[model samples]
Target: MLEVTLREYGPAVSVPLSSEVGRALAASGILQSATPDPVRDGHWLLRAGSRVGAVRTPGGPVVRVMPKTSVRRLFFLLGFSLDPARAWRDSREGTVDTGAYDDVVPALAHAVERQIDAALRQGVLQGYREVEESALVVRGRLRESEQIRRHFGRTPPVEIAYDAYTVDTAENRILRAAADRLLRLPGVPGLVRRRLAHQRVRLADALPLVRGQELPRWQPSRLNSRYQPALRLAEAVLRGASPEHRPAGSGPLAVDGFLLDMNKLFEDFVTVALREALREHGLTARLQDRHHLDTAGLVGMRPDLVVRTGDGRIPLAVVDAKYKVEKADGLLNADLYQALAYATVLGLREAHLVYAAGRQPERFHEVHGTTAGPDGRGVRLYQHSLDLSREPDQLLLALRQIAGRLAGATHDRDHEIPVR
Candidate 1:
C-alpha cells in the first residue's frame, strides 16, 4: 500500500505505488499521472487535481487527499458567509477545530450538524401540507376511489384528503434523510452522530426520500430563512452521498468520495462577494445572465456575471470569473474574446475578467477598431487578480475593490458624451 498525501490547490507530489494501486488511482480520476518517474523505477509522479477527498481501493486505501486551507476558509470559498443570528457560530467559535479534519466529508458533516442544531432551537418548522388519510370520520374531502375500494364491504371507515399543518414537510423530510445518511458515514464524530440520530427520531413522521424522488422546492421567506444554510449543506451532503460508478468493470468495487469543482466554487465565491459589495452602491449583480448575441437568436451568450440597475433590466457592466492560473503573458485570449462579446452584445464599452493570482500581475487590454457600435468605439477589458491564498478578510476586501472599480467604470460610461 502506498500512502499519498495531497494538498488543495498546490503542486502535485510524486507517489511510488505498486501497479495495482496505480491503476486504481488513475481509474478513480482523483489523481493525474504523467510519464513514469525516471529516477525511481516503477514510480509515478502523480499530482492531485482540484478534488479534495479520500478514495478506498480493493487492495487498501491508496490515497487520501485533503484541502490545504482551513475549513473556515474552505467554507468561505464555497460561498458560505458568517451569520451570528443562526445557531451555528462562525468556524472561529471552536465548534470545529481548524485543520483537525483530514477529509472534507467529516468537515461538511460537522458544519451541517451545527446548522441543524441552531435551527432546531428556534423550534421545529411546520408548514401546511395536503395529506390523505382513511379514518372512521371524513376530514376535508373524500377520496372517492380509496373510499369505494375500502368501503365496498365496510362503512365504518372513510377516506379523506385534508390540509394539515405539521412539521412533516418536504423540507424537513430532506433534512431528516440527510442526517440519516451522515450518521452512516465513517469518521463522523460521536457527538455529531448522536445529534443526527436524535434529529432523525424527531422527524420520524417525515417521509424518507425514495429513489429518484425529486427534492421539494422551497421559497425563501421569514419563517424558512433560518433553515437556509442548513438546507444548503444538506443538499450538498445528499449530492455527495449518492453512489457514483465508472464505466462497467473499469475499476475496483465502487469507491465513495466527495469532491467540489474548484472552478464553480471560485466563481460562486467571487460572484456572491461582488454582488454583496455592489449592493452598497445601489447596484445588483446577476450570475449567468443569458442574452442573444445575434439577431437570428441562434447564438446565445451567458456571461458569468452582469451588474445591473436595481430594476435588473438595464445592464451596466459584464464580468467573468476565471479559476485558472494565468501564464506569464497574461489572461487567455479566449476569455478576453468571450468578455468582449458579452460587452459588445450588451451595448457596454467596458468589461472585466477576474482570475486567481498567478505569475503575471493584473493588466488591461484595449480592443480597438470594433464595429460593435455606431461610432465604432473600442471596448476596454479589465483584468483583475484575486489571491485565494489570502485570509478571508483580505480576499473579501479585494472583491470589494473590484466591485468599486466596476461601478466606477459603469458610472463613467453612463455620463460619457458621444464624440460625433
Candidate 2:
C-alpha cells in the first residue's frame, strides 16, 4: 500500500493521491483537513490536528500523522496518563525505548510488544471465568429453569453455568485483541510484528474480542498485579483509535488504524499529576468536576480540575488545561474569559489556566467587578506553562510547583490574606 506522512500542527503539505483515496483519508479522521491542491491536480493538501498516529484507508495510502514532540515524550505523557500512580514510577511502561523507531505507530508497537513480553514472561495469566454452555452432563451447576424452557425437562443436553479456570480471561483477551489490532495496521516494523505474532500465538487459547463490541472489563487486584501494566496499555491501544470505515461504494474496503488526541492526553496528564501532587499537601482534586454556570443550572461547565480541602466538596481552586499551539498574536483572550467564568461559578476569587509552554510565559490577569475580595480584585486568572519537552521527572516537578501555588492561594483565601 502507498504511504504518506504528515506532522501534527505542522505546515500543510501537498501529496499526490486520487480523489477517492484523498476523500477516504479525510473521512478516516486522522488529519485536521485534507483538500484538493489549488494548482496541482490529483494532489491533496493535508494538515494534521492534535490527533496523531497512523490511519490506513481501504486500499489507499497509509496516512501517518507524526507528533511535534519527540516519540519519547509523547509516550511518557501516554504512560503517565494511563495510570499516574504506577504506570511511570514502578512499571516504566511509558519510558520504554523508542529511539529505534521514528514513527509513533512503530514506537507504540515496540512499547506494547515489550510490555506484552514482560507480562507473559511467567506464562499466560489464568483465572476463573463464569461461563454458560449446553452440555451433555452437568458440571458446576445445572440451569433447571433454562432446561425446562428449552428442553422441556430433557436430559440429553443440559443448559448449565460453570466457572472455568483457564487463560481465556479478560486480561488475556485484551492482550490478544491489542496485538491483533497492531498487526492489522500498516507501518508496524517487521520484527515488532513477528514478536507480536508470537505473543498472539501464546494467547491463542484466549478468545478474540468480537469486532464492534465493547472491551471486556477487568479490575485491578493483587492476583492480576503482574498483568496490570500491560493490560492498561492494551486497553489504551484498543480504545484509542477505532476502525473508521470508508463510505460504501468504495469496494468493501475497511479502514483500520489507531490515533491518540494530544489535547486530551496533555489535559489528562496535567490534571492527574496535579491531583497526585495535591494529595501531599493534604488537599483533594476532582477531575472534570461538574458544576453549573448559571444559578438556574441551565448552563453547565466542567473544569479540568478542581482542588478541594480534605474530602470536602467545596472547591478551592479551578484549573483548565489548554494544549494549544502558539500563534504569533499571543495566547487567545477567550481562554481568559473561560477561566473567569469557571472562577465566578465556583465562587472563587482566582482561577488557573495550565497550558503546554510554547512562546508564552507565566502570567496572571485581574478581572474587575467579578468578585469582592479583600483586595477588591474581581477575580485573578493565573496562566501557568508546563514545558512538555522536559524530562518526565522535571514535568512532574513543574506540576508540584503548580500544585503548591494552588494550595497557597487556598490558604491565603481562608485567612483573608490577599494573594499576590
Candidate 3:
C-alpha cells in the first residue's frame, strides 16, 4: 500500500505504483496520472486534480486524498451564511468540525444528522401529497381500469386517488434515502452510521426509493421553513454520494465519493459576493451571461460575471474568475485572450479577471491599439487576486473593494468623451 498526501488544488505527487494499481488509477480517471518513470523504478507522478475524494480499488488498499480547505469553509464560500435562524436549535451554530472526521463523507453525514434530528424534533414534517390507493371505499378520483381489474364484480371496492396530509412525504423520503446511502458508505464512523440508521428507522413510514428513483420536488414555505437547511444538505449528500460505475472488465468496483470543483466554486462565490456588494451601489450582476462570441453566432461565450445597468440590458463590466496559480512572470496569455474576447464581444472598454492568490501580484494589462469599445478605443484588462485563506468578513470586504473598482471603472468610461 502507498500513502499519498495531497493538498487541495495543489501540485501533483509522485508515487511508486505496481502495474495493476497504476492501470486501475488510470482507468478511474479521477486523478490525473502521467506515464510511469521507468528510470525512477516504476514511479508514477500522480496529481490530485480539482476533485477531492477517496477512491477504493478492488481488492486493493484505498487511496484517500483530503482537501486542504475544510468543508465548512467551502459552504461559507458558496454564500451560505451561518445565521442562527438558519441552523438547528439544538445543534452548534453553523460551524462544522471537519477535523473530527477523516473524510468529507463523514463530516457531511454528521452535519446532515444534526439537521435531521433537529427537524424531526419539531415532528416529522407533514405535507399534503397526492396519494393513489386501491381500497374498498371511494375517496376521490376513481381509476376505472384499475377498479375493474382489482374488483371486477365488487361494488364497494374502488381504485381512488386523493391528497393526504401525512408524515410520509417526498421530502421525508429524500432525507431517508440520503441517510440510507450514507450508512452504506465505507469509512463512515460507527457513531455517524448509527445515527444515520436511526434516521432511516424514524422515516420507516416513508416510501423507500430505489437506487435511480426520481426524487420528489418540494418548495420551502413558512410551514416547512425549519426543514429548509436539512433539505438542502440532504439534496447535496444524495447528489454527491450517488454511485458511479466503471466500464465492464475494467473492475468490479464502484466509486462512491464527494468532490467539489474548486473552479466553479470560486466563480460562484465571486459572482454572489460581488452581486451583493454591487447592490449597495444601485447596480446588479448577472452570472454566466450568455453572448455570441462571433458574428456568425455559432460560438458562444459566457463570462463568469457581467455587471450591468440597473435595467440589466446595457453591459458595464465583464468579469471571469480563474482558480489557478499564476506564473511568476504574469497572467497566462490564454486567460488574457479569453478576457479580451469577452470585452470585445460585449463592446466594453475593460474586462476583469479574478484569480486565486499566488506568487504573482495583481496587475492590469492594456491591449494596445486593439479597438474593442464601441467608440473604437483600446480595451484594458484588469487582473485581481483573492486570498481564500482569509476570514469570511475579509473575503467579503475584498469583494466589495473589487466591486467598487468595477463601479469606478464604469463611471470613468461613461463620462469620457471621444477625443476624435
Indicate which candidate wins on TM-score: 2
TM-score of 2: 0.92
Q: Please name the candidate that would achieve the greatest lDDT relative to the true structure.
A: 2
- Write the candidate numbers in order of decreasing lDDT: 2, 3, 1
lDDT tens digits by residue: candidate 2, 1-420: 777778888889898888888877677666788899999998999998998888876556788889888888898888888778764374333545564787888998988889898899998899999999899987999888988889994556999999999999999999999999999878899999999999999999999999888999998999888888788888898886545566556666656688888999999999988998999899999999889988899999999999999986778999999997544444578987899889878889889888887554455667756656797666788777888878788788778878988998333344332223
lDDT of each: 0.70, 0.83, 0.71
Could you tell which candidate, 2 or 3, scores higher by TM-score? 2
Per-residue accuracy of model 1 over 208-229 as CA lDDT, tens digit each: 8874566777776788887877
The alpha-carbon lDDT assigned to residue 158 of candidate 1 equals 87
| Backbone clash numbers for all candidates listed | 0, 0, 0
Q: Is candidate 2 or 3 superior in lDDT?
A: 2
Question: lDDT for model 3, on a 0 to 1 scale?
Answer: 0.71
Off-target runs (Cα >4 Å) in candidate 3 are 1-5, 9-24, 34-45, 70-72, 78-103, 144-157, 240-245, 248-251, 359-362, 372-377, 409-420
Q: Which runs in model 1 stand beyond 4 Å of their true positions? A: 1-4, 9-47, 55-63, 79-103, 133-136, 145-158, 240-253, 292-295, 359-362, 371-377, 409-420
Task: Report clash pairs, candidate 3.
Answer: none
